[model samples]
Target: MKLFFRLAKYLTPYNNYVIGAAISMLIFSLCNIAMIPLIARLSEAIAQKSIFQLNLVVAMAVGIYFLRGAATYGQGYLISFASQRMLFDLRTQLFEHLNKLSFDFFQKWRTGDLISRSTNDIDNIQNGISSTVIQLLPNMLTLLGAICYLFYLNWKLSLLTLMIIPLLSLIINKFGKEMHKVSSDAQKKTSDISSILQEKVAGVQVVKSFAMEKHEIKKFKEESEKSFWLSLKQVQINVTQTPLLAFIQVLGMVAIIWYGGYQVVTGKLNPADLIAFFAGIALIADPVSRLGDTNAIVQRSLASAERIFEIIDLEPTVQDAVNAHDIEIKGEVRFNSVSFKYQEELPLVLEKVDLKANPGEIVALVGRSGAGKTTLVNLIPRFYDATEGEILIDNIPIRDSKLHSLRSQMGIVSQETILFSGTIKENIAYGKIGSSDEEIKQAAIAANAHNFIIELEDGYETVVGERGASLSGGQKQRVAIARALLRNPRILILDEATSALDTESERLVQEAMDKLMQGRTTFVIAHRLSTVQHADKIIVLDRGKIVEQGKHDELLSKSGIYKMLYEMQFKEPA
Candidate 1:
């Protein structure tokens, strides 16, 4: 009930349309109620053979029905228009809220589960508000008018009809709870299936390589069967309850006909009045059954609303401070006793780290797999804030600067390049929006990518497949470098950038890297010891602590961790 009221707030903006719908519904209800009693009068007029009176009754019936049709159309149109506008507003809010969420939120929730909430869950809300309520409102109004008319004709008979109300309410309450539970379970099953489909489709190469096609199909079928059974249960409740409520109403109708007939035969009432009373009872039955179905619709929609609000209610852990502002950067980055862990319960990934990179210096990080090489550089960008202590850029704490302003001064290129599904030119230009054609070409040339790009059939206009599948990995890395160069940041981070490429590709990418590193504060995480040999300063980390720091040769001569790593990589096998 509380959830339903909260959803009603969306309808306030379209109150004028609601007003129009209400007015039309009122007239439609009055016409329906008036037509029932008029039927009794028409029967008498025909029995008397009075042609003039009979014609008058017949004409009024036609006119009333014509008005009813127009009113029904108007109410339906207005209500539908308002409901659709509400849906648009709600969907936009949900999507915008998703964008404001932090990186960790995406890591925790499955992609398919989020997509299902945004699409399928919202559709359920739409059905409840737009389709069910539109019909439900008119039925409820007509039912009320029919009950009033039944009482005016004979209070005893009306009171007898009212006896079924408590039983009907009990039935709706019992089954509505069951329906809500099943609906929530069914929606979750759908989300699970969607997750499986997305994972299998996106990782199709892995599945095919492992020959798990049969395994995947069997899993999918089992999930589908679960959803099917849940849906059948929901349908069973709906189908069973509608007739059960209708049968209860039929019991009331039976009692009314028997008692009213006895009154007429005993000279206690007119035939026409008894006949009109029965018509009113009949009128109320249909709407009562329709309203029972509406109860199930409401329950299903409320279940969906709960899931959607869970996302909307979430507050992002990472957000800009109230006093944060943009700052000018000269690429001097410092880490002062910075320590970090992804979560509070986990051990530190980086412990008591202290480092500095002056303007226009190349600092290369080299270490074993579990060492905090990448985590140390990630502090500069504030991807995850330091668990203890602070990091500074250009003599000011990074926490005092706006997130976008700080990140805009830096660029990154990773071993696995992420290229969107778009033309080659568009993908490169994404680094700097509104970049010109000539500027994009210049960046590509600097990364040694311009020559190969021009050799393609469509040149810069070639559409890269999903994650740039159409291009070889070496080509993708080059494009990534071109994108970084376009940003023209004062600081850059390269994480195992050329470690995955062949010898020829590595040479070309290395040349591009050398060109890009000039006059910038660069942090390089290198797996191949040869790549960092010329770095202005080399920092060797072991177990999340800096073990050595100096020029490449200076560190190598000391017989420390750096020397051991160098020998492990470049030494000839015995």
Candidate 2:
């Protein structure tokens, strides 16, 4: 109910359309009810051989239907227009809200589930409100109008017909509860299926490499079958609901025919009146049966609405403070008494870590995997805040700085290069939007990527596939470096940026890295000991704690953790 109210607020701007639809629906219902008397008049005219009366009745019926058609068109058009606009606005808000969420939120929610909430769940609400609810109003009005006319024709018969309504309502209530539960389960299963497909499709290369295509197909089949069964259960409820309601209506109709016919035979009622009353009773039956189906749709939509609001209601753990201000940085960064754990129950990934990199200095972090090298650098950009203590830029805590301004001053290039599907020029110019062609070319040349980019058939216009899959490992890394360089950030982070390259490719990328690092506060996380040999200072970490700190040569002379790691990498292989 809360979510429904929230969603309804989106309709405020288009209330006029809703109003138009409601008015049209009412007019349409009145036109339909006007047919009952015309039908009654036609029956009387036929019995009396009154051709002129019959012609007048036929003309009146035609005019009533014509107005009904016009009203129906107005109702359909206005409601559909309003519903589509609401869908657009709601989807836009959902996507924008998603972008504001923190990394932890993405970690907790599966991509498939999020996609389902954004797409399928939203679609469910649209269909339920626009199609089901729009039609439901008219069906209910028609049912009411029919009941009133039945009572006018014969009070006793109408009272008997309405007696069955309470029983039908009870049945509808029971089926509605069961249907909502089944529909919610089915939607979850649908999300699970989406998750499997998203995961498998993104990792198709691994599946093919491991020859696990059959295994993946089997897993998908199992999930799909579960979704199918859940849908089947919902279908069973839907199929059962309409027939059960119809059966109840049929019982009422049976009593009406037996009593109304006896009244006509006993000369207690005229044939035309009896026929008109029967017509109204028949009119009530279809809409009443349809109401049961619409209730199920409403239930399913409510279930979907719950799923969508769950994400919208979440507050991001990482957000700029209300008083946060933009600051101009000078490439100096400090981490003081910093500690971090992904979650409180987990062991700290960084423990009381203290570090500093002054303007135009190169600090290299050399550590084994899982030693918190990436985690340590991640705090500088506020990807995750320190669990204890604080990080500062030029003596001011980063927490006091606006997020966009703070992040805009730094650039990162990780081991796994991520480039969206777009032209090479677009990808290179991504960091600096509205960058001219010359600026893009300059950035590419600085990264040593221009030569190969121009050599391609489309030159800078060549389209990179998803994740830059069309490009080689070295090419993708250089492109990523170009993107970072284009931003012209004061601070830079290179996390094993060239670890995946061959000897020749590494030399080219290293040359580009040297160019990018000049005049910037650079933090390098490297597996290859040779790359960090010229660093101003080297920090060695082991199990989330700094074990050694000095120049690369000084660390080697110490013969400690750094020396052991250097020896392991450079040792003679027999």
| Ten-residue region with minimum lDDT total, candidate 2 | 127-136
User: Cα lDDT of model 1 overall?
Assistant: 0.90
Which digits, one per residue and each the tens of the lDDT, describe model 1 over residues 55-163?
A: 9999999999999999999898998898889888888889999987877789899999999999999999998895455878888889899989888888988899899
Q: What's every prediction's RMSD, in angstroms?
A: 2.3, 1.7
After superposition, which runs of candidate 1 have C-alpha atoms over 4 Å from their true positions?
A: none
- Give the per-residue lDDT of model 2 (tens digit) for 512-551: 9999999999999999989999999899988999989999
- What is the alpha-carbon lDDT for the whole of candidate 2? 0.90
Report the lDDT of model 1 for residue 126: 93
Q: What's the lDDT for residue 465 in model 1?
A: 90
TM-score of each: 0.93, 0.96
Model 2 alpha-carbon drift over 4 Å, by segment? none
